[model samples]
Target chain A: MPHRRSAFFISDRTGITAESLGNTLLTQFDTLEFKRETIPFVDTVEKAQEVAARIMNSADSDQHRPLVFSSIVNPEVRAAIKVDGALCIDFFEAFIGQIEGELVQRASLTVGRAHGMINEEKYDSRIEAVNFSLTHDDGVKLKDLDEADVILVGVSRSGKTPTCLYLALQYGIRAANYPLTPEDLDSPTLPKMLLPFRHKLFGLTIDPVRLHNIRTERRPDSKYASMDNCRFEVNEAESMFRQHGVAFISTTHKSIEEIATNILHKANLKRRF
Target chain B: MPHRRSAFFISDRTGITAESLGNTLLTQFDTLEFKRETIPFVDTVEKAQEVAARIMNSADSDQHRPLVFSSIVNPEVRAAIKVDGALCIDFFEAFIGQIEGELVQRASLTVGRAHGMINEEKYDSRIEAVNFSLTHDDGVKLKDLDEADVILVGVSRSGKTPTCLYLALQYGIRAANYPLTPEDLDSPTLPKMLLPFRHKLFGLTIDPVRLHNIRTERRPDSKYASMDNCRFEVNEAESMFRQHGVAFISTTHKSIEEIATNILHKANLKRRF
Candidate 1:
């Protein structure tokens, strides 16, 4: 049997950075099973010590050195978390010195600065983009279609809305999605409303089998969820994409992040970070 | 002035994991300036060689080693990316061997498994949670309120919507948010609509200064954007949180990720990863 290890992601703030980095590292080792936990907002020595005790308890039970991935910036808190029985990999401690040497400057060592409130303008822009996505979802509003960074077109369940939302929330991209209905997919040409903004159009297509399954889950036994309808919609969508010279991707085997990043790359869109 | 270095986030697939982990490490060294780029879909040796050339060019122009953070799983592709004149930190190559030894099993060496379509049920659940958040946003659908994992109550701009979306998209949480209005604030007890779900209620507060700035952007000179109104709303909202014994956090100095993670921790909600 494979050994089960306890992995802790600890940070002074959200612990997202710690978790993302740690999870990436752990994914490479697919043979082991891991029980992961995140301990965020550990900015004080008391909180750090409490976390240390938890780590010790887990290590004692597992009888293996628990892997601790920490991003605590406070020196005192970082020191407090360096308890025995755990193999601590402090991101700041491990790389800050090297980076400082490379840059020929001293780091401020501020707590929570990585994900803290630094710029209100940027935050407002993100919120505005999100509101834009919400308002323009599912072809609801097309008045300011030109303002969108990218306009996604797809069948009802081709993973357009989630991809648009992810792009807006994560990258501050003004994404709007329009669903390609059966009437719109009747012909092999682009829809009339999308012709003027063809340059901003990106298509998402899914496998007919996957689309049928997804649609069946939403509305069981409906004509819209039929295999024949899904197959026709996907085929017509692809032909339209090719005929109109619109770049399209199949979302059957991709995550939302993958689809969003691929769209950004293919469309040469810059992340607003 | 700090020396600027060229940093590349290279990966076999979406490059999100590489970019995220690299960004976190770079944030710790806040004193330096980094010219960042992401090269995704490097699954072949030819593509890896192409990325290697780009890295070498950047290193040559900057007169310093370009930092390459990679999660490429293909051995040939990984070898091609390990070109000289650049400092390569391969996440998969660094740890997979140790993990295989620990587990006593060879990994599958699959590409893009970290963020790929390994499970459709999880994807469907995320989409369902996102739809739930959208429908329940701003108390739009109060029916079946008990189905929510957490219900956030706060002023209009207290950072509720984005946090709910983030929780849903990232953690598969069925989060619903209700904006606290002046009518609700007039009473000392929890809102009648929220009384039945008090155990699932979490509040968000913000500094009046920041709240005024956020509201003023939307409604330029309205009474709702006035500083006095902002102060009254924030103060009353916080007092209501205390009177109702509802847990709350101030979003003045925190990011959306921070607020969402804190809410998950406080509510003791398990992330459906």
Candidate 2:
């Protein structure tokens, strides 16, 4: 290492995991500057070969023997890449034996769970697509809406922020969510500023009992997290979604992805990203 | 059908794709209430069966049967899910047939390349563990920078935003990135805010040539996008990272995931969400 470490993350799939893992370890080796790169979707041998050549060429030019960590799916392509002479750490090779052994030993029904259940864009789009669309007034600047893609109208803690950020980070859609206060839920009219965009309005409703439990996790034994109040708010929000023609999703047992996707469908909108 | 039609999104994975398609179609229907739900991690028959049961139960209790869509990888799991009495759709199912046909017509590689990689996290815990920290700092106050599991430092367009957002969204790390401007570069000093947290300071840099190209995409031919300036700034930033004893990652060709992971590795962080 020449006062700097050039690092490469070559992945067969999206490469998110490799990048995340790599970033964490690099901080320890303080004396070396880490020059990083990611080659994504390297699914074929040709692609792998091209990457190898690039690394080899880069190594020759840069005086550092690079540390490359990769997650490639094809065995032949991986073998071809190994000859490129970099310090290669293969995630699959290291884990496969362990995973295979576990699978054989346990014979468990579960294979594995997908990480976080969605890409950044698609995830964000879902959250942004389903918020207080029916209530926004005309001439409101996009930013003034607190950067909401679609503001969700619902009782407290119906999974709005998590869903909205999921939409933004996953899909590059700006989604801002505001809880429907008890007054907003009870009244026939919505927040005056959101009137024009009611057409895009979506709502969220969860079983009161479930909502109570979820809120309890955040702050236990508060009226805001009350089971009776949650039930009332959720039911009222459902009524509001119906009366205002605002589409909504239930957060009862569904994951964030499901709720976001449902809202997108209801709105008849494509992903913003 | 009720007097109104709402949007619906379903996912074997996350119902993002289905929502995308539905957002367009819901407009043709009557005034609607949106409804979204998902069956998380539907990669196994047991998970699929659980999802099907939930959908059926929801349908029986509600007047309208919710629209369902999903992305499931396993064929058997997908089949098991559709047995529920819902207007269900599988996202990957749409492409599975095509992939199957392709596999049948042409020889497919048996082992995927990603199989050989070592599990760096096994030996490298400090960095790998914290690559993904929770975002949505709803709880983490800004004043608490020193308390952060990791903090990212870089100049604008140096891959800070996406990476931080990824950490926040995927790993639930409360990530905050600060931009280093020319004045900071000129002084040969770390930012005053960063001096106390020298151990937490991590830097992100890019190949000025590549940075110039990326900036050009956002604002063509602007001074900010000038290649020479980018090169100057990059050189200076790298020096700062080194002089300040801060580890850095060059994001010349890295994706958000790669950059985020690199940041994570150096930070000794973990996803709290």
Candidate 3:
């Protein structure tokens, strides 16, 4: 049996960077099972002390030393988190010195700038993309289809909506999705509304069994969730994409981030944020 | 003026971890402007060679050496990215060996597990949260408010929608948001629909000036976008939050991640994924 290790992702801001970096490294060691916790917004020394105490307590309770991934910027606060009984990987301390040396300049040592609210332009664009995605979701608003960075077309439960939302929320891409209904799937040609914007159209396809599983969770024991219907829709959608030369991805074994990033690369769309 | 530098975030998978970690580190050096690009899915030796060529070309064009932040796991592919004239910071190489030594196990050397599709439960939960946030947006579908992990309440354009969406997408939290309309803001008490869910309610406030800016972009010259209306709405919303003792954060200079993380900590909500 694999040993259970406590892992801490500590940051003065969102802690997302710490968490992502830590998770990326941890995946390399498949032999261990990790119990994870994220401690965000540890900007002050008092908060740092609390985080240290929490880490120490968890370390004491655990058989193995806790693994801590930290991205704290303030020297004072960063110093306070160097608790015993844990292997602390201070990402800022590990890399910032090298970066500063390479650039031949001193870092500002400011806290919260990495994920702070200071950049209004970037923030507005992200919010704008979010609004655009929400307004145009599920082909609700089709008049401004050309304005979308990418228009995802697929049958229901093919992972169009989540991929679109991920593109908007993560990369600030103005993504809109058009669900290919049963009628549309049966049609010999592409939908009329999508022809003009073919270059911006991307398609998503999924395995019939996986689609059935997803649809069953939403609406069980119905024709819409039936295996036959899922297979038919997926086959038709994939053929439609191939016939029209629209770039597409299979979402069966891919994460939303993977699908979105692959679509952006294949569609040659630049992320706004 | 500070020199401009070309920055590349390279990864074997989606490049999100590389980009995020790089962006966080680069924020400390505010003096330099970066011409940034993310090269995702560099899982093969040929792709690595192409990325290396691209980086070298950018380095040739740039006055300063390009900074490359990479999270490539494949040793063969990682070797191809060690291009001259670019300061490559290989995240995996820097820390993975130490982690392996600490764990006393060999790494899987897998290409795409960090943000991969292996975890179906976590992926499904994220999609569920996205669907939940969409259905319950702007106080819609309020009958099952108890199902929400966090309920965001704010006035129009106070950033309730994006924050809720972020909470859902990033943390897999079922976040529903209610916009505090003029009618709701005019009253001294909280909305009746939110009374039963007060424990899960998290308010969002923004500077009136910033709110005015955001509203003006959506509904230009309208009463809701006017400065006086913005001021009145913000003041009323904050006062109502205070009167109701609802936990709130100002969205003026904060990112959606910042706002969501703070709310999660304050509300004591657990992430589903």
Candidate 4:
């Protein structure tokens, strides 16, 4: 049996950066089974010592030294986490020195600076974008269609809402989604409401099988969840997009991050963050 | 004047991991300014060369070596990006070898694996959480109050909605937020609907000045946005949280990421992602 090892992502702030980079690296090592834990806001030496003790305990239990991915900015706190039984990979320590050398400057070494409230205006805009996306979700509010950076048009279960939310939250992009209803799909021309905003329209289509499965979870045995309906909707949506020169992509087997990033790349929309 | 250098976050997939870690590191250098660009889907040698050329052009124009933070996994593609006249900091190259040595195993070296659709069930749950949060936002639907992992209670514009959305989107936590209205604030008791779910209740309070500023943006001079009303609502909300033995945090100077992470930490809620 493969030995199950513990991997820790530790940071003085949210630990999001450590988790993200560490998880991505871990994905490359598919043979290893790791039980991951993220310890965030470990800014104090006491907290760092406690984390080190936890790592030691895990190492003893697993009979292997645990891997510690850290992004702590403070040298003293970071030193406290470098327990003897752990392979502490300090991300900040590894790169900050090189960055400082290249830039010919010193690091501020501030805790909670990465995900803190650094820019009030930018934070407010992000919140505003979220509100905008929520208010205009699923073709609910067409009054402020002109204000949207991009309007996603897709079938009911083609993954529009989540993508819009990700775009708004991550990039502060004012994304509004319009669900392509059966009535709209049946018509050859684009929905009349979307005519003026053709340039802003981006379609999302999904594999019929995936769409059927997704819809079945929401409403079992309903016509909306039928395979035939899903196929028809996706086909019609793609056709509409092609006819109107509106770029689109398949959401099947894609994460919301991929979908949102793809849309931003294709649309040439600048990320606010 | 500080030399304004260009920073590129290059990746095989969405480039989010590169951008996230790179941005966090860059924030430490307070004196230097960076014009950042993320070039995603650089999975091929051609794409990598194009990005490298862009970096070179930026370096030539600025008369400063650009910083390239890359997470590309393909060896040839990654090589193409390490062009002259730019400081390429390959994130994967920096740590992957050490991690491989520690694991005593070879890496899969897969492209697009980081943000790809690796787990369908996890992805679906995240979307479901987003839907649940949206349906239950601002006390819209109280029927499924029992289903929430955490219920955030705060005065209007106290940063509840964005935090809930962030928790749902990032951690797959079924977060629901309730607004403490004027009527509820006037009373000393907690809302009747929230009494049964008291253990799952988390309160968010903002500084009265910040709350007033946020509310004023929404409703310019209304009684709801007044400084006195903001103070009364915040005081009442915090009191209710204290009186009910509920854990709470001040969102006056916190990003949504911080607020969500802090809540998850306090509630001990397991992150689905």
Candidate 5:
């Protein structure tokens, strides 16, 4: 066991900003190893003190003090942690004063999604894309899909690539997908590309009516986004999946995360996140 | 802007696991429009309650207790959160006990890398690869390129892919990389592939001596991993970078996180966690 070093990301708001910024900093110290923990969205002195003690407990070298990278905005919370002798690196310490000064001058400032919030939104977008993709997955690249933990098959614009990437980036699952082309939909079977990996295959479906609206956004007045085509594909695709014993999900109203999780759960797979 | 339905991820071990798992679950409930945050590596009741309040504060409806999915290993922490009225779902609640129970009949089962402390060893590998790759990164990529958040140029085994992926995945930066072929090192200012992205480019160099040994592992007697060739390439690459005012890092003992951050910090760019 090498010498143990750890850092705590403590926050007054929700700890998301603290964690994101702190985690990013910790990632930089790859040369110097440190154990990391995030204690988020905490708002009180008692809570802060308790978190301080837990962090202190992790520091076998110091009984009375521990190093903490804190981003608590409240003055009192900061005071409480100080009593614990924590070496906190405040995220806003350098920015707040500058921002307040600017506020006095009334310079316009753009607040981003919460430090944690932005990543979540980006991830959510990917998830939304994935869920939407399941219905349209036609399984084109199933043969060379070494990296994908699972393969999503669906039709055009049914949302596969974004979900695959989401699974890859978020859960470290190598998820590759192929779109369902017209030929595959014209046939009564799942694409032959998926037959070799039937065990890992999953599908997504949607209300043709809803999908038509989504597709129309990208390629309006085209047959690809036409309502009749959307309905035919949805019905044919659902039957094809059923005939082939492939599991599918309706993405009509579900969010990507919901769709992905539901699929993961149904598949009896444990998420790596 | 939506009514914030709250979500939580708590853990007894490093909250990273909890967050990772929680993030996957939170991906579900797309229609619910929830507000979510993670409390990573949280191990105590005090910590759980601490995170619980953050969830409570963010909730929009009085009738709904925030949905919390956590993995605190300590029974005490889980119990504490339960008493506080946060709807908690976690790996501990879902699986730790099952793992313990299984230990009685079966050989101990192990999960993946989260259980390991290999950061230091991996960092060393990355750094060593960096120094070695410098022999390959020509000045072609380092000139006049200003739009790059960061450019990572290296060789076949120089750890460029992992490093680049880490930078983008962890930091949300659009990192583009091009390999330095041996041909570029002989007469190059830099590889032409990189010439267009010059100002944004950063070179990753590693100890040629270490790299030769690494290459030898993959191919026992290949000319590619030879010490003489590595040394010759290393000298030319470093000189090319210097001639073009390209600042570089010897990644002979750094982690992906560290290398990326150093590049970001050195470039005066803000890090995204």
Candidate 6:
């Protein structure tokens, strides 16, 4: 059996940065199984020492030194988290000096700046974008269509809502998603509401099998979930996108991050964050 | 004005990991301003060379070396991005070897695994959580209340909705947020509907000034957006949480990521992703 190991993502703030970097690194080692935990807001030396002791305990029980991915900015807190038995990978320590050298300046060593409410304007804009996306979701509100940075057009269950939400939350992009209903798909042209904003339209299509499965989970034994209907909807959506010179992508096997980034890239939308 | 250097986050997939790590690192240098660009989907040598040329052009235009933070897994593609005029900080190259040495195993050298749909079950749950949160948002659906991992209760505009969305999107936590209406806040006790789920209940409170400002933007000086009403709502809500023995956090100056992580840490909820 492969050895199961414990991994800790420790940081002074949300630990999101440590988790993202650490998870990406761990994904490269597919053979290893990891039980991961995030310990956030470890800004004080006392908290850091407590975390160090906890990591040491895990190492003792697992009989293997656990991997510690830390982004603690305080030198004192960083020093306290260096457990003897753990492979402590201090991200800030590893790169901050290099960055400082390159930038010809010293790091501020401020804690909680990465994911904190440091920029009120940016943060408020993100919240505003989320509200905008929510209100305009699934063609709910069309009056403010011109305000959207990008409008995603797709069939039901082709992964539009989640992608819009991700775009708004991750990038502060005002993304409004419009579902291509059966009536709209049956027509030979794009929806009349979307005509003026053709440049903002980005289509998402999915494999008929995947679309059918996704719809079945929501409403079983319905025409909406039927394979034939799913195929027709996707085909029509793609045809409309191509006919209108609109850029589109398949969301069949893609994560929301992938779909959102692809739309931003294709649409040339600036990410507010 | 501080030196406005160009920083590029390059990766094989969505470049989210690169952006997250690179953003955190850049935040440490408070004196420097970065014009950041994310170049995602650089999976091939040809694409890598293109990005390298782009970085070189940025360097030439800015009259300074651009900072490139790449998480490209392909060695050949990684090599292609090593432009002469830019400082390439390869995240994978810097840490993968160290991890391999510690684990005594080789990396898979796989591309597009970090943010791709690698785990269908995990990805499905995340999408499901997003749907669940949306349906249950703003006390919309009270049925299936027991299914929530954590139910957030707060006054309207106390940062519950965005925090719930972030929890669902980032951690796959089935977070349902309930707004404390004026009538509910008028009483000195917790809402009867939330009584049974007290253990699963988390509260969010914001400063009265912040709440008033947020509400005024929506309602434009209505009674609900008045400063006096905002203070009353927040005071009553906090009292109710205290009387009910529910854990709560202040979201006055917090980002959604910080608020969500704090709730998860306090609730001891395991993040699904």
- The positional error of residue A98 in candidate 5, measured at the CA in angstroms, is 37
Q: In model 5, where do residues sit more than 4 Å from their true spots?
A: A1-148, A156-159, A165-172, A205-222, A225-235, A249-266, A269-273, B1-149, B163-171, B207-221, B227-235, B250-261, B269-273
lDDT string, candidate 6, A172-250, tens digits: 9999989999999888698998999998999898899988988898899999999999989888889999999989999
For candidate 2, the docking band is incorrect
Q: For all candidates in order, state the fraction of native interface contacts they contain.
A: 0.46, 0.07, 0.77, 0.69, 0.00, 0.69
What is the per-residue lDDT of model 2 for residues A1-273, given as tens digits with 9 covering 90 to 100?
344556787766555545533443343233446678866657678988898888887677777566676655456777666744567765444443432342232212111111222233443233233222212322234446754556666776676655664555455555555578887767766667667667656778877887787678668998878887788788777887787777777766555545665565565544464
* Candidate 2 TM-score to native: 0.54
Span of ten consecutive residues with least summed lDDT in model 4 chain B = B111-120
RMSD of 4: 1.1
User: Which of the numbered candidates is closest to the native, going by highest lDDT?
Assistant: 4
Q: Residue A150 CA error for candidate 3 (Å)?
A: 1.2
Task: Evaluate every candidate with DockQ and list the scores.
Answer: 0.52, 0.06, 0.75, 0.73, 0.01, 0.72
Task: Return the top candidate by TM-score.
Answer: 4
Native-referenced TM-scores of chain A, all candidate models: 0.96, 0.52, 0.95, 0.97, 0.53, 0.97
Q: Model 5, B56-145: lDDT tens per residue?
A: 665535345576665443556667766344555544444333322422222122221222122333332322233222222233344433
* lDDT per residue as tens, model 1, B128-223: 889999999999999989999999999999999988899999999999999999888887888888989999999999999999989998998989
Candidate 5 lDDT by residue in tens digits, A246-272? 888876654333455556556655454
Clashing pairs in 1: none
Q: Give candidate 6 regions above 4 Å deviation.
A: none
> Candidate 4, residues B50-98: lDDT per residue as tens digits?
9888999999998899999999888899999997788899998899999
Tell me how far the alpha carbon of residue A95 in candidate 3 is from the true structure, in angstroms, after superposition: 1.3
lDDT of 2 at A156: 68
What is the model-wide C-alpha lDDT for candidate 1?
0.85
Q: Which pairs in model 6 have colliding backbones? A: none
Candidate 4 residue pairs in backbone clash: none
The numbered model that scores best in DockQ is 3
